[model samples]
Structure formats: structure tokens, C-alpha cells
Target chain A: MSIARFSPFELLLLKSRSQVDTATLLLLAWVLVHRQHVSEGQRRRRLAQVTAQFRHGHELGPIMSIAHSQDLQAIQLAAEVVRKECSNERSLSALYQAITLATDDGDLSLANHYILRFLADLLNIAPSTLSTLFQELTGKPLCPPEDPSRDAYWQQHDPEYHARQAQEAQAAEQQAKEAHARAEQRQRAQTEKQQKKQQKQQQEQQRQQEATRNAKARAQREQAQREHDQHEQARRTRWQQEQARQEEARRRQQHQRSSSPPPADRTTRALAVLGLAPGASRTDVRQAYRRMAQLHHPDRFYSESDHLVALASARFQRIKNAYDYLMQTY
Target chain B: MRDLYQRLALSPSANSHQISSAVTHCANSALRQDAETVLGVAEHRDAYNKLHKTVSDIGQLRARLGLTHGAHWQGDVANDFSLPPDNAISRHDELVDRVSYAVSLYNHWRRFKGPLLLVALFTAGAGIGLAFGFTLGLGLGTR
Candidate 1:
């Protein structure tokens, strides 16, 4: 960067020629544009020198403008070349500007048989989306130079356009909030109504059940009262029949006793059959009966018929009942 | 370390049901690990002891053959992989370092016995010399 030790060739290139030719400038531009090995700082410094003519706008104006012009043929050529060959962001931007300027010249039609010119119109889309479309069409990214919305463009359109967008966004947010609140309130109201309706239905069902229960209890009580009345009536008839039967049985017994004569032998000698002497002690009579019962007990013979067994068992029961009754009466 | 926890069916939660489910998931994942790769870790651990015992038996059988310390007595028979405190990778490095250092020391001892033989000879010579001097002094003093 110091001037004292400058190379002779640099001094010659800077001062020897009053003006540089286009071919040399083009060569310099080629090297600066296609530089790969140079460091980034050196590259920028070199490219700045190479493009100084375009910035300063001194000479080579006619050829440079012609090479990138607003003429119909020139713009079409630039567009074609850009789609095919322009790789850098700056060249693409230049081509796009050229196409827009040509359209402004009014040679291209609105829907016509000529070149396409919606270069400025494409700005309506998002830059990223535009870049993607360009890549899809061209097979490579066509990055615009320095994000075309620089201070010059943004200063003109930022306030009113962005303000309108912000307003629309705020309105949409408010609308969504109101819609959500309304939906929640509607849901809560519907839930409360359903709950109240369920409560009323349950209360009605409970009341109906209680009434049915009470009616059933009353019916049961009446049925039980009818059953008790019928039982009492039957009991009275049974008691009356028993009283008549008892009186008839007693009269029959009295008639038999009065009509029958006394035994001629006048003896209580049934026990004498079992070897009991006259005036025997009760123990002696009981011993004789036991001996006789043992000899005649149906259980002693497996071959005994059920009728014989029954007769023996009945005789035994009669003797027992007579003994028990006599003992109590005595 | 992660695989170890997953293998052990250990989970990370306070709720018993969720923890149990997570533990099941961990065990299932461990069971499904590419057995060709990870299954050998267990086999290798088991075979390590087998190799140690075999090498020791073989070396003892062939004590003359130069495989003296083929099986080392000092070794970690078990290793539990877990997240290390302070440094995780350092533990692995430390284990490897210990094994390497032990192996080197065993190799050196097995190969070299020069200084040891020399020390033994020197001590034996000194003992003999002391015994001879004491006997000579006793004989001369008595005479």
C-alpha cells in the first residue's frame, strides 16, 4: 500500500498511458471477477480499481452503456446472456436493471410477441421465494446484488407499506382472539345447560322411583292385611269343628262304659300270662314283661315281615303309653 | 454409559408407573441392539477371565517358555461403565493407562534379572567374608 516502493510496471500502468483501453479493463475485470487464489481483501482492492471507470463515469461510457443498454435488442441480449452465463450477484442485478429500463422505454408489449419484462414487478414477491424460483428456472441461484432494497429504495416505501402490513397483522390477531373467546364462552354455556338439564332429569327420575316404592309398600300392606283376615276366619271354623268333634267323642266313650258289663272273673290278671303271681310287686311284673318283650322283639329276627315288625312296635308303644299314663295318674 | 443404564432397565422419573414403563423401554431397546456389535462386550468380559486363567495355567506349565507374565494377578475383573465425575473420557484413558503400565512393568521384570542377581551375589560374598574374619580373629586371639 506504500507508494515509495511501487513496482515499475504499476507506475507504468498508472501513468504511462493517459487512458486505458477497454480490452485491458476487461482483462482486469475478468481477473478480479474470477479470482480464486487471492485473499478476500486483495480481491476487493483489485476489483475496486478495475471497476473505477464505471463508478467515476469518465471514459468508455459509450461502449459500456452499449454493452449494457436499454435498447430492445441490447436488453434481450443481456437477459439471454444473464440466464446463460451471468454467475455473480452484481451481473445479475445489472441485467435485471437493464431489462426493467428497456421495459420502461415501452418497446415491449403488455402481453406480447416480444421479450418478457416483469423485472421490477418481481419485487412484489419475497426475495427468498424469488431466489428459489430463479434457481429452479436457471439451475443456479441468481442472488440479487446487495439486496436491492437499499437505503434509496427502502426510504421511499418503508413507512406507509410496513405500517399497513403491521395494521393488517394486528387486526387479524384481534379477530382470532375474539373468535377463540367466543368459542370458549359458547362451550361453557353449553356445558352448564347440559348439566342443569341432567340434574332436572335425575330429580324427576328419583321422584318417580320414590312414588313407585311407596305405592308398592301400600299394596304389600293391604295384601298382608287380607291374608291375616282369611287366616283368622279359617282358624275360627277349625275351632268350632274341633269343639263339636270333642263332644261327640266324649259321649261315645260314656255310652260304651255304661253299656258294657263287668268281667265275671273280676281279675286284673293279664300279667299272669307272663308268670306273675297274684299281688305281685311292680318290679316283678316289669321283669316278666321285659323277658316277654325280648323274646318277641321284631329286631331279634332278620326274617320278620314289616307288618309283624309294625305290630310288635305298636304293642310296645301301647304298653309304654299305658305305663306312663298310669304312673302319672297314680 | 447410556447403554449400560438402558441395559440395566433403569429409568429416570418419580412416578412408579412411568418409571417402570421407561425401564421396560430401555430394556427392550438394549435387547434389540445390534447383537453382532454390542453383544460381544459381555462375551469379551467373560472371556477375559477365561483367558487370564488359561494363560496362567499355560505359562506355569511352560515356565521355561518366555510367557512369564501372560496372566497378571493385578487386574480389574469387573468394570461398570457409568458417567464419570469431573471427566468422562478420562476414566477410560486412566483404565487403559493402568493396563498399559502394568503390562510394561510385568514385561520388564520378566525379561531382566541382572541387578537382582548382582545384589544377591554381593550379599552372599559379604556374609562369607564376615564369617571368615570373625573365625580368624577368634583363633588368633585365643592362641
Candidate 2:
């Protein structure tokens, strides 16, 4: 390679100690030089030139030693120059074609990925975009297949995690159902207690209302009874007053009849009924009438014989009349 | 016997003007010195009241005798009723004199008013400083 062209690739391989073989070097050089052109004649001429320059075994040792001697700053400067030169699609297409040719069995190996990653970084291509390009060019997966050592770890733990999660979900479901049942029971008990309390309060109010009504009825009955007793007493009093008036009238009539002494022809009969003399004053007639009443009153005939009672009644009548007549004459 | 005129610091034959002026001067001096509280000690107020009653009595007696000036006099009453002797009158007079003396001394010392104010300010500042230092010490000790 020319000093100007070799400097950048030297920078890209600065940290790589594994030496590139003659075939890979020639192939990489041919892809870089020939695929940049479109004509078949120009591609053949460039491929011959790259093969003739680095075909010898002795040339690779010097080239690799010189690449190793370049410092990080020099490498970076050379990479910048190369990135400006090879930023187009043409150079990237050439790199993909070269990587495809370098891979054995049409599938990328670890060493192939390392080389592709290194070149893609220098070329300002994203790692993921480069991986896709590598797969497209090589007709294989960008990453290597997982070894059984790594796969065995996941295979051992995946079912355990799934089973644990299923168990946890079942427990949670059971717990939720139990909690719901308990809450329902508690709610039912609370409702029942509230209903009982309400019923008790209603009964208490009913009892109070009944008692109030009973008290009112009793009061009314007592008032009616009191008024009835008062009326009865008044009726009795009126009856007694009427009876007393009747008795007084009867006594006055008897007195009037006794006072006149049956029109006596002489004053002697009248005086005898009165038990007074013919010349008696009004005082003697009154005294004799009072004495006759005391001895032969109707009130004193309770234990007497029937004939004696009649006799005393007639005598009293006569004595009363005679006394009244004497009082008038005097 | 010391009479009412002696208690009022006037002659017995002095006119009303002399008696009023003496009373006014004594009362003004006592009030300025705040002597009412001093007189209120133990029996001092009682003594002063007694002196005041005696002066009032004598003044009334003189006025009544004067009102009957042109009228026919009843009898000779001058030598019959003499004023009673009283130690309270003298004691009250002495107390009033001492109060006046003390008031005069207080007014004289009032000339150093500015220095007294400075001394008061300094005392207040020192008290504040002492309190601040004590608080600072307590805070440091707790820490």
C-alpha cells in the first residue's frame, strides 16, 4: 500500500496484535481498490496492482510492525483522513463485499465480527446498522449462535418463575374471595343489628304513645265520674229540700185545723181542749198547748197501741185548734 | 397654751388675709413635696387634722363674735373660754417644715440631671451586655 493509503488502515489496526494472513490482506486490499470503480477493466487492473504489491510473505511482517508502531494520536488523525475519503456508499459497499469474502462457510465468526466492528467504527457506521449489513452480505446471522452453557441457565429458571407467579396469583385470588365473604358477613350482621335496633325503637315509641293515650282516657273517665257524683249529690239535696217543705206544710195545716175547735157552742170545750179556764189569758192557752204537745206528740206513738195512737192524734188536733181559737179571742 | 393662731403661724389678732396666706403657703409646700403620704404615717394625719379643726374653730368663733359687733352683747366672754393646749399642732408644724426642707434639697440636686441620665443609660447597657454573655455561655456549654 502507498504511505497515504496505508496510514489510515494502520491507525484502524493500532491495537490489533494478531497478524493478518497474506490471503486476507490481499483480499482486503483488492476490495478497497477495485470495488471503488464501476468498470470491469479498471477493477481488474486495481486487483492486479494490490496482489503484486503485498503478495510476498516478507512484506506482511514489515507492514504489521509499522502498523503497531503508530501512536493513538497518529492513528486517530489517519482515521479522520480515511473517514473523509471513504464516507460514501461506494466504500461501505466495498467493505461489506470484502467482509463477505473473508468469512468462512458463508457465516460470520467471532474474529469476523471483531474486524467488521472495528472497520464500521472507523467508517462512522452504527454498530446495529453494520450488523444488519453484515448479515445481508454474508447471508447469515450477525451474532453467533448461543452456546448450550448459556442456554442451560435460562432453561433451568424460566419454568420456576412461571410456576411461582401462577402460585402467587392463585393465592391472591383465594385471599380476595375470602376477604369478600368476610366483608359480606360483617355487613349482613351490621344490617341485622341496625334493623333490630330500629324495631326496638319503634316498639318503644309505640309503647309511649299507647301510655299517653291511656293516660288521657283515664283522666277523661275520672273527670266524668267526678261530674256524675256531683250531679247525684245535687239531686239528693233537691229531693231532701222538697221533702222538708212538704213536711212543714202538713204540720201547718194540722195546726190550723186544731186552732178553731169545731165551732164550740160554749167556750168550755175550747178551753178544755186547751186545758185552760174560761177566763184564761193568752199566756195560759199557749202554756197548756205546749204541755199537751209534749205528752201526746205523734213522734211519741212509736211503742203505743193502735187505738191509743189514734186517740192521741185526735187529741193533739183538737188541742191545737182550741189553742188557736183562744189565741184569737184573747 | 398654743392657740389656733400659733398652729397657723399667725398672731391671734391677725386678719383673715394673713391667716389665708399662711394656710395657702403651708398647703402648697406640702403638696409639692408629696407630704400627704408622709403625714398619713401612723398618727401624723390625725395630728394634722386636729390642728386644722382647731384653726377652723377659732376662725368661726372670731367671725361669730365679729357678727355680733354692733348688737347688745350677752356677757363678758373673752376670759371665760380660752383655747386648749395641744402638742399635735407643734408636731404637725415640725413635720411640714421638714418636708419643705427635703423638697428644697431635691430641687437643688436636680442640677446634675444630665449626668444622672448618662449613669442610667450606662447601667442599662451593662445589664444587656451581661445577659447576652450569659446566654452565649449557656449555648456554648450545651453544644
Candidate 3:
């Protein structure tokens, strides 16, 4: 309860926030701050007074003109002049005409300018302020609101009111032109990117062609070397076979003369014939097999796993079976 | 003829504003009258007064015509001096065709400025008495 706690905005927004818990507090706050100085009823009455004054033509004077010199003799005549000039409908029309002429022509009587500017400014400020505040608070329009004006019809209907609108329109057109230019730039950039993509593809094709040409040269060189190596190896095997036949003949002749085998071979033959190292543990066999398999693992040949697996299994199984037979027999 | 018809057809109600308005208008209209409009408008005391005694001479000439009448019909006679309606000018009608025009006589009388209203009254007596005496031819005066 106490209303002195809520802020001014909170107080003013009470109409929209009535269902909220703080509404009572806000309303009381509003009354506490403004009610003492100006009550709601008093505000309405004052507004009515203002309207009444408006009807009575109690507006500020914009200009003064001297007319009917002999008739207008009073010393305090200026005060009554404006009201009297605007008394009836015809005079009121004349008064408005004078004001319009003054405004259009400018350099009008000082009085006329002041009065018109004042009325226009006041009316403009009041309604616009109220509208902005209400709109901000209510989140909806305050339609059919009071205008209390005579020129609203002109303002609303005259779409092409010959004010300074043309200047703004020209500026807006220029802005549109700039925006269009930016769009064109974006389009140009997109086109450039597409052109660059085509260029990059052409370059990649050129690099691939270069790589193919280099690969063809490397394959030709490698093929020549491989053929040369095969020829050398065949020559060596032929030489060895020839040497073996010669040596066999010479050894037969020597054996007939000496009847003894070559020492190196006899030694190896004796060892193999005796077969002294027959027993071996699984660890020893595995160690010996690992050493041999390491030299022939699939990584050494960079071969496929399927081919490596087949070759490794066949070789290891034969070795294991021979080793196992030797161990069982001995 | 059109003007005459207009005047004849006009009712008094066709006029304007107030009776005083009509009176004021009529007076002001006579005051502003020129020689052109003077030919047809009413003859009043001011018109005669404005003539500067041209009427007295017309009256003296009319005094020779001795046709008199009994009572005053025109207006009050000034100093009881005026002329009768008949004169030597009327006797000329003896050798010519005679035509008595009342409106013409009234116009002539109005044109005279010197006591025209009074003279018209006095002339009626003179014209009637003279006519009776001329009828008797030797009639004596009755006391």
C-alpha cells in the first residue's frame, strides 16, 4: 500500500497495468504526486476551459494593422481589436485570410506570425506527445483521438503538400541508387568468384597433366632398369652353371687321384648326418621362427594382407612340422 | 406606353420598407431631380418656390379671363388676389374648335411658381362668376 514507492512511468502506465499487483500502488502514487497539484476532474475542467478559450478566439496576436483611423480612436483599442475583428463569421473569414496571406507572404505583421506559429506549435506538441506516450504505454493505437483543429482535413488529404517533401524524396532516390550500386558490386563479386573457380579448375587440370607426364617418364626409366637387371641375373646364373660342370669334372679326376671329399662340404655333411641338436623348447622354436618371419613379414614387401597371410602360414607350418618330426624321432 | 402601363399597374403595396422610408425616399428623390425628370414628377410647394416668381406673371395674364367659380378648390389664396380661368385667350376658341383639357390646365397652373396653389383656388371663383354673367348677357347684380 503506500503509493509513494512507484516510479513516474509506473504510475502513468497504470491504465494498462491495472490487473498487475503493483497497479494500486502505481495509481496511488500518481494521485499522491499529481493529484495534490492537479486532480483528474480539475484537469478535464481545465482542458474544457482551454477549449472554450479557443472558441472565443483567445489566441495570441500575430499582427496588427491600422484601419478606419477616424473610427478607431480608443487608447486601449488594441486589446479589443483582434476579438472584434473576429466577431462574426464574415469577419472571422477575413481574419483567417489575413493570417494566411501574412504567412504566405512572410514579413507579415509581427503579431500575425507570432500568433500563428504559437497556435500551430502548441497544437502539434500536445497531440503528438499524448499520442507517443499512449502508444508506448498501451501497445495499441489511440484511434479517433481528438484533434481540435480546423486544418486536419488539408493535412490528411493533401498527399503532395507542396512543403519540403521533394528534397527528401530526392535524397531517398540517391540512397536507392547507392543501394543498387552495392547490389551490383555484390553481383560483380559473385561473378568474379565463379570466374576464379573456373580458373582454379583449369590450373588443377594443367597440374594433373604435368604430373601424368612426369609419371610416364619415371615409369619408362624404371622399366628400362628392371629389364637390365633381369639380363644381368640370367648371365650370372649361366656363368655359375658353367663353372659347376667344370668343377665337377675336375673333382672326379682329383678323387680318382686322391679319393677324398672337399673338407668344407665333408664337415657340413658330418654335422647334418649326426643330427646332434635334436631337442628344442617351444620358446626356442618360436624365437627362431620369429627371426625368420621378421625378414619376410608383409610390411617388408608392402604386400596385401591376404597374400602375406597365405605365404606366412605355408612357410611356418612346414618349418614347425619338420622341427616337430626331428624332435620326436631323435 | 410601357412606362404608362407600368405606372398604372403598380399597386401601392409594391413599394418598400416603411411609410417614412417612402416619404424620405420621395423627398430625397425630388431634391436630386434634374431637368430631365422634372417633366413628370409631382409639383409641390418647393418646386414653385424654386421657380422664383415666374408664376406671378402667368397669374396676371390669367386674370383677364373672367370665368369664375364659387368656392376654393385648389388651395388657400394669398392676400385674396388671383386670376380667373377664362381670358382673351379662351375667346379665340370662338373661331376654332374648343377642347377643354383638365390635366393640361392643371399642368399649366403647376408650372406657375408664384402662389400657384392659391391662384388656382382664386381662379375657380373668377371663372365661375364670369361664366354666369356671360350667360345672362344683361343680368343685373343681385345683392
Candidate 4:
């Protein structure tokens, strides 16, 4: 793949064996390519670009200082090391990265082109390949027309440049404020959603509790109804039993009354046996009993046959029984 | 007339003197003793005569009421005047019958209560278990 997709520091680190050597080489190449005198603003801008590409921001300061010193021996050493460490493809990729960095300002100086050619020669790349790679990256010939109008060095000293810088800074501050407001709004929306969820859960719990209470109350009422029905059944049974008992007692009393004879019947029969009327006096009952007794007495029939005497004895016994009954009843 | 008077073949108006002579001349000693017991005491004779009189009066009443045959009387004064088989129950006997009825009812309840209670408890437990299982199933299904 072409190293055009990779940043300058990333390509340098990938091709170099040591991280410190790669950083030094990358910075040294950048400084050498921008060797012409430039404004401090341009220098700081270039340093900012390098620092942004470098993964380790804290270490870039010392590497940038060393590269800015323009020490020829350190430059030569970094170049030699890069040349020895890189293969042909990696050497081409490293050179391509450097070309990309140089064109970031929209232009390359003649001196920067010379330095690139020197780096290509040191890495053993053919001059034709360097021209082709540079053309491919920048869409221009290796040697191009000098255009001072494209150079920003004079504009950096202009009053309008300072005003544009102030405007850009103000716009950046306004964007930061808007971003903070959006984040606060998102946080508020999230908190409100959480509170709504909590309220829904509480309402569901209350509904479940009400259902449970209703079920419990229904069970209690059903139990009470069952108990009441049982009590009613018992009461009905007792009432039925009491009614049966009263019926039996009434039947028994009726039976007794029906079976026993009346007292008046006995008095009339006793008077009849004495040969007296129903309303006869006690004296008349006695006189009739005595008269019947004398006539039917067994002693008066003693001279008769055994049969006759037996007959007389039975007759006399009846008359005697009737008299005794009459005397006591009267 | 009473059986005692019938046994001696005597009239209903026979006196105490004639009753004694009849008893003395009776053929059977047992018959003589019975006749003596019934006729010798005025109170016993009265009770005997009254019993026969009650039977006779009942017969007369039946005739007056135009009830033919006199099925319950039949001139057997001893049987007729005897109490009507004493069918009325005593208090103790009735109490015993009532207690037995109560005991039988209790036994019937006892016979049913154990299985009924077990069925009730089992039904309640099964319902509770089913409800609990259904609730747990719903909860798990929701999850």
C-alpha cells in the first residue's frame, strides 16, 4: 500500500527499529525541508502539526527543540540511521510521508525540493521514482514554477490576518458553549426518563397490592358465608328435632287417654252388680246385696248333689264380690 | 262380672257370708284361695268389680256407639281391664333412645369429618400451590 494514507510520524515509527530514533529522524527531516527562514507563527503551526501526528505529545517538545537547533551532525546521523533501517518500500513510504508534510502548507520551496532529493539519494531511491511519487502525491512536477503569491509569509505580518485569527478564536469559543448546552440537555432528558420509569414501577406495585387485598377480602367474606350457612343448618336441624319430640309426646298422651276407661263407668257397673239403680242410696245397695247373698248361699244348698253345690258356690261368690265392691265404692 | 265371680258361678249381688261358704265348698284349692283373696277383702273385691265394671261399661258404650263385634272387648274381662300393654315409654328409656340417636348422628359426622377435613385442606393447599406456581411461572415468563 502507498504510505500516503499514513501520517508522517506513524510511517517513520513503522519503518524505524527505535521509537526515539524515529521521532528524531522525522523531526530532523521536517526541519531540513523547512530550512528557509520563516515567521514564528508558521514555525509554531508546523510544530503543532507534528505534535498532533505524534502519538506521545509530552516527548514532542524535546524532539522539536533538537530538530530546530539545525545541528548538521545530528541531521546526518538521523538520515544515515533512517537509510540503514528502512527497506526499499519502507524508504519510499518514508519519503512519501515527508513529501506529504511539506505540501501541507500548499507549496514546496526549491530548497525543500533539494533537501528531499538529498534524502532520496541517501536512501538509495532513484531520482525518477522520487519525481513520480512527488507527482502522484501533489499532482505537480518535481520542479515547478516559483509563485510568490501563494506564499503566506507576508500575509502573516498583515493586520487582516490578526483579525481573522481573533474571529476564528471567538467562533471556537461559541461552538464550545453550544456543545456544553447540548450535553446538559441530554443529561436532563436522561434523568427525566429515569424518574418516569420509577413512577410507572410504583404504580404497578400499588395495583398488585390492591389486587392482593381484594382477593384476601373476598376469601374472608366467602369463609364468613360458609360459617353462617353451617350455623343455619344446625339451627334448622335442632328445630326439626324439637318438633318431632313434641309430636311424639302428643301421640303418647292421646294413646293413654284412648286406652284407659272413664271413672264414671266403674261406678255405674258396681251399682248394676248390686241390683240397684244408677242413683240408688247406699242403704238400698246394701239391702239388695244381702237379699241376693241369702238366696245363692252355698250353705243352704249343702244337702244337694256335688254339682248343684258347686253351682250354688259360684253364684254365691259373685253376689259376695258385688256386695264388697258396692260397699267400698259408696 | 269379674273372673272370680264367674269361676264360682255366683250372682253379682252375693254377700260376704255367701262368699265364705262358696269358698269353703270350692273344688280346686287354688280357685278357692283366689276367690278368698278377691272376695274376702273389701278393697280387693272393689278393685276386681270395678275392673269388670269398666269392661262391661266399655262393651255397653261400644253397643251404644253401634260398634259391632266389640273386637277389643270380647268379654275377656281380665285381659280387657289389664293395662294396654304398657306402650308408653319411661323417661329413662326415652332419654336412652334420644342419646342413642345423638350418638348415631355423631358417629355419622365422625365417619365423614376426617376425610372431609383432609379434602378441604388438600384442596386449599393445592389451590395455594397452583396459585403460587402460576405466579412464579408468570414472573419467570416476564423475565
Report fnat in order of the candidates.
0.00, 0.00, 0.00, 0.01
Q: Which stretches of candidate 4 lie over 4 Å from their true place?
A: A1-58, A144-330, B1-143
Query: Model 2: residues >4 Å from true position, as ranges?
Result: A1-118, A124-170, A173-177, A218-330, B1-143
Ranking by lDDT: 4, 2, 1, 3
- Global lDDT of model 2: 0.50
| Total clashing pairs for each candidate | 0, 4, 18, 10
Against the true two-chain complex, what DockQ does each candidate achieve? Answer: 0.01, 0.00, 0.00, 0.01
Model 4 chain B: lowest-lDDT 10 consecutive positions? B65-74
Task: Kindly provide the TM-score of model 3 when superposed on the true structure, using C-alpha atoms.
Answer: 0.15
Which of the predicted structures, 1 or 3, would earn the higher lDDT when compared with the native? 1
- Tell me the TM-score of each prediction against the true structure: 0.19, 0.22, 0.15, 0.25
Per-residue CA lDDT of candidate 2, range A76-106, in tens? Answer: 3333334444545744754565565445345
lDDT for each residue of candidate 4 in B42-122, tens digit (9 for 90 to 100): 755664564454344333323332322322222333232233322333322333355566668799999999999999999
Q: What are the per-residue Cα lDDT tens digits for candidate 2 across B72-111?
A: 1112222112233432222223333555666677987798
Which of 2 and 3 is the better model by lDDT? 2
Query: For model 2 chain A, where is the 10-residue window of minimal lDDT?
Result: A145-154
Stretches of candidate 1 exceeding 4 Å from the true structure: A1-20, A25-174, A218-330, B1-143
